[model samples]
Target: MAPGTAERIARLIAPLRVKPGSRVDLARDFDPRYKGPLKKKDSAELLAVGVTLLAEYQQRLAAQDTYGVLLCLQALDAGGKDGTIRHVMSGVNPQGVKVSSFKVPSAEELGHDYLWRYAARLPARGDIAIFNRSHYEEVLVVRVHAEVLDRQRLPGDVRTADIWERRYREINAWERYLTDNGFRVVKVFLNLSKEEQRTRFMKRIDLPERNWKFSAADVRERRHWDEYQIAFSEMLSATSTKWAPWYVVPADRKWFARICTAAVLAHTLTGIDPQYPTVSDKARKDLLTARRELEAEAPKGAAADPYAARHRSAGG
Candidate 1:
């Protein structure tokens, strides 16, 4: 029922989820390359099933118009976040889904609280919003680089040494509030290995079409890989609450990662179990009246049902 192939796949990847209040040591706790029994060959089929299920659930979610889903994807450069989003969500109606990629904050964004921009882009009722890089960036990148924090322009008194801890508490509380108010939060951390990251960087440079995706800034950021890892571990440990636990997807293999991410989403939507709105007695009566009027408008002695002749002609 999850981002996995079937119930079996979902159970297989359950260990990837970070439990509440559990300490995360990315290097020690999770394997960036672990795929369990799943192979690359099965990814397409598994992903296809997941996508179809997602489309059905998405339609129900929209028709019900009762809840919104927010999928927060946090990853380092070359972590396959973009690819995962593209492939996993390919089947959903474009209008029912939104993909927001958060980059370096603009002057206007910096002027407001770090979460201000994110809060504005939250999913509306009955839709899904995917945050490529989310509010967690404040804890990940900002904590990694002290200068980034200074740029936030917080009051001096608010910039205590325990700012990260305080922010973690604030974020947890904010997410809790969102859950209480009908938005379900699904957080995923794409755990890409450093070696694989280097390989991807080389491929981006080696392929002419992908050269534009490569950036000097990406290389600079790679230098702080260890720092980012530490930041990610801490963030996962502190913020993986019962309401919105983190799914640490093994991201070294793009296909596997996509499958896991899709399964996670499918699983969440399953838990939500959104249903189509039931027609009330009054509405049903009105529908019957409308059907009669439409039938009466047909030509005299002609079939009131447009498809009736077609079905007879086709020997249906």
Candidate 2:
């Protein structure tokens, strides 16, 4: 990798990372429309480079078959999570990538433990799995709307005052366990501003093609913006651990957000340092023998007049 490329990637990611144990105040700590030091054109160019590098790294990761990457994206409605995934991850080979979008859980999912539905979607070794919205919803949306918990039918004690804190701890421990077991978790929160969200909502409402995306419930949820903000801030402060820190990317500028996401992923995959597996001496020897046999079977004089006999037989 070029040093300049590495530096660009570092700059793109540095401002966004919420270090472990660091308190996050959302309003004070992050900007929803930040574009860093790069101009729009420069940011676009850098993102192209970063996306190419990410594709290369993903290929090596798949070939090594020794590590798994889990990318978790969390955001409010119309926050561009889908756009980030589409544009940033477009270069990667689909066979090596799996994307699971978590929505309202089915009755069967609600019957299991909160984490059970997510556990089954984890990436296998040599693969990258992306979660459009992930397990964090348990703490974010569920925390903001306590009534959702009533559906869980948990014992009163289990859903007591300390439940949020307990869930945060469990999430941190779960992420630590995943890191210890060869999975690298990259979590991103697309920090979209309320004003930007309203603009997007209007576009969804007025545009014929996007009408299907507009929902009355989205407007209903926007009424709780402050509550969601508080929930998100608390979640970030509590769960951004050493093994799996969160990058709160500014989402108002869709292009810049996409670039930030691509840069973070490129940087993370580079740190993993995946490579093609080395061949053992015995395997190398077998390859050599196979090569020799293939070479030995080459037709004599083919190089000088490869298709001469065929042409003559056809009376050309």
- Per-model TM-score on C-alpha atoms: 0.94, 0.92
Clash count, candidate 1: 6
Q: Candidate 1 on 1-316: residue-level lDDT in tens? A: 3443457656966988999999999999999999988988888998898899999999999999999999999999999998899999999999999999998899999999889999999999999999999999999999989999989999999999999999999999999999999999999999999999999999999999999999999999999998998999999999999999899999998998999899899888988989999999999999999989988999998888778777997995
Residue 155 CA error for candidate 1 (Å)? 1.5
Global CA lDDT computed for model 1: 0.92
Report model 2's TM-score to 2 decimal places.
Answer: 0.92
- The TM-score of predicted model 1 comes to 0.94
Candidate 2 residue-wise lDDT at 106: 88
- lDDT score, candidate 2: 0.90
